[model samples]
Target chain A: MSLAEVAKNPAGTGQKLKLQHLGMVYGQDAESVPVLEDINLDVSDGEFVCIVGPSGCGKSTLLNVMAGFLPATAGTVTIDGEVVTGPDPRRILVFQERGVFPWLTVEGNIGFGLSKLTREERRQRIAHYVQAVRLQGFEHVYPSDLSGGMKQRLQVARALAVNPDILYLDEPFGALDFVTRVIMRGELHRIWQTERRTILFVTHDIDEAVQLADRVVVLSSRPARIQDILTIDIPHPRNISSPRYLQLRDDFFFWRNPVAGRDSSGPSSQQQPCWRYGISPFSGRPPRSFRRRLA
Target chain B: MKLPARFRPVLFIVLLLVGWQVAIDRHPAQILPGPIAVASGIVDLLRHGILFKYIVASLFRVTWGFSLAALLGIPLGLMLGWFQRGEMAFYPLIQIFRPISPLAWIPIAILWFGVGDSAAIFLIFVGCFFPMLLIAMTAVRNIPSIYINAGRNFGLSSSEFVTRVLYPAVIPQLLVGLRITLGIAWLVVVAAEMISVNSGLGFLIVDARNAGNRYDLVVAGMVIIGIIGLLLDLAMRSLENVKSFHWSSSEE
Candidate 1:
């Protein structure tokens, strides 16, 4: 079947992903440290969910569990009522490091997962997505020759070419500079609108979450559990200057900040509360206890 | 004034020839032949048809020995690298043998093959095998897990995974191993020819020294061997010049 038809039906027609009491613990006995706890979430089909959390939070572990790279310690994740076993091609994960194959050219990487297609169909699909990702002249060029932003775009194209129903992006733009990151976010948002794939993106950037997500899922620090799930009622191509946009963004900032837990007012501090956390919003070392991570 | 890089080697050779002529003027031709005498020796051999015969004999032995080494070593390496159990069973034995030089294998080769082309080829094979095997094993082991994961996710069959993913990933480094092994094989064949056979460059050098104490002929044989080794290295280097193979080393 064509990717559009598959996207329309998806693996789960109604509910795309279901997580219940999902918890992850590393090591055994006294050494074992819990990374996630009592996490329960239900995502609808074709929804764009942005999961925002602190730096050391278990967002990545949760994404890995959902992508079937890691197994949950306590609970189960089901898609279409079937428990997740291991990584499936139908649910592709886009990593931040630009996982485009360095050995292969742009076309080669895009056509990597298109082995099931007939030769002609593979060519057509590869061409379509290459254009979709806006990499026109670089089809024959190796990824090493491409710019950093171009390489990441090529990676996104490779993921989309497979026509996966769910795209799990783990800080896909985290490595890029500010300008490129903004541009990438716009391109990604446009692609999501066109493809309508269910995306669960993890990031520490609240502005990014506010700009892109249909619903933002806020996560607490280590051994993270769902703090709150705020629906972004603001429309797409949201004006950052608008009162409603600033209000929604600050609302997320207030919920995540520990200090904000003290005072319910002062939404103005929402300017960029995510930059510095746990200490004063200005600067100083985080508490020694928070800095020490177990190996 | 500085000459171009290509002329530097030619200039060095000319200066060496002038020095050799001066040295030969002071000494008798019996003990040390001059460049002129060595050139005459080479011409005489070529006129007598022995030059082509010796060159062909050495080339033939090297081709058989090095080809066999590569055919066996590369696959064995891939297997040992791919399967941990295979490596566990075989690697200790390889480690034991790898330290010994191919020259040490000369006695065993003579005993096994009994003074012929087979003995010479066996020595060359011993010289070439271990380096190729180790390099190929390293190449396979060094491949990033991401590539394997990508292969699996893309639905590549096990055979396709090996041929398409593993082979391409391993080849650039393997080519480097092949070049080094070829150099070793060339070195071994000469020594092997000196003892076991009487029809190669090595045999020519030994025969020239022993038959009539023809020092000029011996020097000529050494010169021929050096030139041929340089040509083979150049041929192998041409593979790296190819654009597709060039970028492979830069890949993660």
Candidate 2:
């Protein structure tokens, strides 16, 4: 989704986040390890994109590069025609709940980046976000006092309170239990629909990717490269048990070439529980998607 | 007999006094005064206004010296922990001086300040300074990296980061350092007063023995010192128990 295409296409005029030939390498000389190679991605404004891969697949490294926390070894990440050299207040990265300041209360965390605002303005903004995140009564409570779900919500409120144009979340809900995680996904989707800020969310869960993303980007193993990008055209208020949703979910398992010679149709004994649970537990082989919704 | 917690200490003291009286019966009065004699000595000093004056004098020196040390040491430590170059330049110097007892500084303090309250206060300051510096430095260094990153991400400038994040983060550990340094400062001041000053608990003990072998007055001076040190420690303990500091206490 290039800026030119977005501009020519009257339906979308919002700013596009562009990444060209992004490459990142760690260490030096022989010890130098490549984390990302020949990566190119374009995210249109107001879109929710999820990058999904196995645990050690450098998905987070890619996010850090895009967030301007780590520099790309080779490439330029530009937004609205300006190259990103460092982290800007316009694009905030909401780290795992660990990033929330334990020393601060919910109100304090929300108001942390609002130093530019007047006292009255900061107060109103903080109160609005605290209530928006369903933390109205926990204003004076510290992160340590909050539960996992509440803390993640507090982090979201803190990030959203800053009013950034783009949000980069790194496995934000990975620490929550299954039920809480499912609930949080709905809350995030609701918040995203209401806020309409461009979000690039990183997660390893296939179900999570399918549920929340407008486009789910699949990446190959170490020194990750985009293997496929699948567009989820399903409307919101999505039903997980609905045939279309289950088809898309199961499609990921088929797309992910599970153990080379095995038949893709029947669920093997090892995969039966995962299929029952609706979350593939195994790190199936990297997916090969025939449907490249966006190139 | 059963006693309330508050009365238990009083009962224990009464027993201690009775034991002291019996122990002193085997010795001459000049060698070890009985508890009754020490009580009379305390009353005489109080009536003459000598005990209160000496206490006030000692407290004045301690306050000045401890305040001076705290004012200087904490900032120096904060900088040392924050900047690698500062640690490189000053940490070795701190390590070298920390082990040398403040008693060793007494001769130099007298030579520099010339044998009065200045000499005693200098000794107290030296005793208090190193602990404050080291503890504060460690406290600053121990603040989790996540806090620092969060602070910066919020667009806090370098100075704001130090003042807003670093200071509050280091406070709980720093408070413990303050209480310990004060105890050392009080201990050092007394030793300093015994050698160079004219009026303090230390001076009272020396003067009682020198003027007329008043063992009872010397014993009374010792008792006062113990009680005062205990009180100061209790005050600091209360500060550590405050709600904001409770989080750090759990780590210990």
Candidate 3:
């Protein structure tokens, strides 16, 4: 919906975030390179939305614009019917790199944004989040001392402590190992279940998008526009081994790589190196032929 | 089978002393004092109390000059680094002035302060200020944008942003700069005292040379300066052990 439509029917529409006709271009005139174009999206209160695209497809740029770190060349991002002119504490962005402040201890990082709160309130909130993220013992330890997963959890705890209305996660687990990434995703889902904050996550991993998001918004290669939006009809605590899950996962794969879906020459045609096609083949169940080879 | 790390330095120092004594044994004591002569010369100065007085005088100049430079340069550099326009305007000017030796400023310092502690202190300040400023500026520039963005997203006001983000972020690098700049200040104070002051270690060396050729006292002064410089560096290095600064280094 457009900003005017949202504004006119503010009480009826429960959109926590509305992006209308968003466009972004770097530089000016002859040097200008377009990144995102003619994009529109609406996210309801407490909705979990994920944006998935190929690498270097302006996914980060889109998140930056939404977080108000960068100005869109031609759009208005309205949250709760108010225009987003700059960053606000109510909307926090968690970076892919361990964005936890290395200088501050775990408790210190969680308490960083709570400077305006009274001492007792701040202490209670920090303690609550410390336990929430399962970092009970390491409160006084710095980020450098923590393992990669712990550091990412600390970043999440720091964001959650502020009680923000929305959390923008820009490929937050992209730096983690395979096992750690899966563990972090489960941890994030648990947090989301308890916290109920609107989360707009961006990632290149399609499996991550399907596993976490209520609705997955797929974007095409740059001058990024919304190619399709798929709503996962499955319930929470989704069974990865379920036939429905496999169907949806394969559908997303084929949507991403149409040629591979069409050319059904007994897995040989699809045996090309994944990186050349920008496909992540290791995510869920590998192909039957690959599984047989491995066995 | 191997010597402990702690004893290696002591062994090296003993070898150095032995090498020095052997090199100087053939020369007349008047031409070059041996280690024993230099040690005796130090004891003699201490007995007369001039050694303590001269050391204090040199340290006093360095303390005043280096403190003044740090007090003024750090804030100015932070401001310039945060505001790109200010950096663009002033950085080239700083680059032009930074290359000229602090010794070259000796004449101007003397002309302004007129051959005393003030002149020496001014030269030391000149030597230390540019380095501190450059270090602070580069430190601010090197801060990851992620930190700054996170700080702003928390709705920090301008002053809060500086105090909560900029200051803490630059501290690790600033400590390194302060250590190096203080070393420069120490070096500059001695040179400044040689030409413009009457009561510092540099004066003691020059006076010993000119009056009755006390080569023992000259070597004694040199040894004292080296020892004091090492102590100063050790003191500066201890700042890195503070808990807040530990994140910059790999070790816990």
Candidate 4:
């Protein structure tokens, strides 16, 4: 459905976001290389889409281009059929690194860029996000004092406060501990249910992708191109222990595992490496690889 | 950070002072005035009101020069740090000029500005500018690219990126540079003052030396400089404490 079907005409009803034949390239000279290619996706007015891939794949690049943070070497991202030219308050991207304004407290961070609202209006919004993110009573504390999890939570509150039509979260929980990541994933789902907004998330964790996304799109290694898009028929508040959950999680791993077409994914110790796009994990040394078996 | 609990330099200082007192009294040399004699001369200078006037004049000169250097150096350093063109073009020239001693510039400063506070301050500026500028530029460049990209991804313009992200990221390093430069300024001020200034701590020491080797006045001036440098560093530390918005200790 288009954004026009879900909401009133000007507000965009049916389709909230559409990426048509998207491709991205970086570097100016002979080094120029495509990061994402031949990407076509349509997210409904209020759907959760997660893109998972090997670490070096261009998942983040695709989202960055959609947010208008990077130039798309080919194709276009449109909202309500209008092409994205630059970052708008309508589309806010929250990153994994916990990009909180150190100078601002929990409240101030949420209220930043909320220039259109009055002081009272902003206070109400700040208060709302504070509660939403379970960051209550941290209003006066500067970002420096918060733990890693709290800082990421603050980023979430800040992005949500702007009432972005579609939120872009680039591995928002990647930096957190396993426990915190699970908790935040749950909280994020709760927020989506309450707010009912479209969200595009990027993560290398197959379990995380399976847990959060209504549909999971897996991408190939460097010069990332979409490999497959799996619609998750599993119900909300998914149970990882359930047979269905385990199967969906296995499907993601099976494709990403270079040796999945063979019997074993690989030697238990040598799981497929997921290289993040754009960044050279190590210029000279070997690629950064996490070999822990997912299945 | 406060000194380590194991640090008890005061006992060592007292022992040194006692040793000085013993050496001077036992030898009784005219050229090497004893600690008591130096202490007496310091009292005498203070009583006569000369010490206060000289210290104030020296402070006036140093403050002007150091502050002026910071005003010029910080901006230049920030530019060098932030702008690729400026860094590539000016860094080599700055590196070459940086190694020259402040005294080398003193003679030129006197020729250009004449023998007064202006020339002395110019010499001090020369002493402080390079290190402060280099440090500031380094701080600007050292900010992790993650922070810069965060700003860019948010659609911050170039100026916004610098003002909001770059400057804040560089503050801790810049403050450290400020502390080092201030100490250098104090050292340069005293030496610069000794060359031509008629009324300052440097002159007082030289003037006293001219009249029968008044070691007391020289020792007193040196002690005063030490005290001032200590206080300025303390001030910078406090400023750092207040400005630190993120607690780094938690991470490392």
Each model's lDDT comes to 0.83, 0.82, 0.85, 0.78
- Can you write out model 1's per-residue Cα lDDT over B33-127, one digit (the tens) per residue? 89998999999999999999999999999999999999999999988988889888988888888889988988999899999999999999998
Q: Which stretches of candidate 2 lie over 4 Å from their true place?
A: A1-15, A27-34, A56-59, A219-224, A247-295, B1-38, B212-215, B241-252
Candidate 1 lDDT at A270 equals 31
Expressed as tens digits, the lDDT of each residue in B139-251 for candidate 3 is: 99989999999998889999999888898889999999999998999888878888997888999999898898999999999999989999999999999778898567752
Task: State the displacement of the C-alpha of residue B101, model 3, in Å, after optimal TM-score superposition.
Answer: 0.4
Q: Write the per-residue lDDT of candidate 3 for residues A98-156, one digit (tens) a residue.
A: 58788899999999999999999999999999999999999999888899889889988
After superposing candidate 4, which stretches have Cα over 4 Å from the reference?
Answer: A1-13, A256-295, B1-8, B26-33, B152-166, B243-252
| Model 2 Cα lDDT, one tens digit per residue, A24-142 | 99999999998898888878887888998767779999988887878899998998888988777778888775777766788888998998899999999999988788888999987
Q: Residue A108 in model 1: shift from native, Å?
A: 1.9
Residue range B62-141, candidate 2, lDDT tens digits:
99899999999999998899888898898999999999999999889989999899999899999999989999889988
**C-alpha positional error of residue B202 in candidate 1 after TM-score superposition, expressed in Å:** 2.0
Summarize candidate 4's per-residue lDDT along B1-252 as a digit string, tens digits: 676666669767778889989988888866566677777877888899988888789889889999999999999999888899999999998899999999899879989999998999999999999988899889888877656665665556677667767777777778778888988988888888888688888887777788777677778777777787798889877777764433332333
Q: B-chain TM-score, every candidate?
A: 0.94, 0.94, 0.95, 0.91
How good is chain A of candidate 4, measured by TM-score?
A: 0.83
Clash pairs of candidate 2? none
Ranking by DockQ: 3, 1, 2, 4
- What is the per-residue lDDT of model 1 for residues A116-212, given as tens digits with 9 covering 90 to 100? 8999999999999999989998899988788888888888888889889899998999888989999999999999989988899999887899888
Higher-ranked by TM-score: 1 or 4? 4
lDDT of 1 at A251: 58
Worst 10 residues of 4 chain B by lDDT: B243-252
- DockQ of candidates 1 onward, in order? 0.40, 0.35, 0.66, 0.26
The deviation in Å at residue B93 for candidate 1 is 2.8
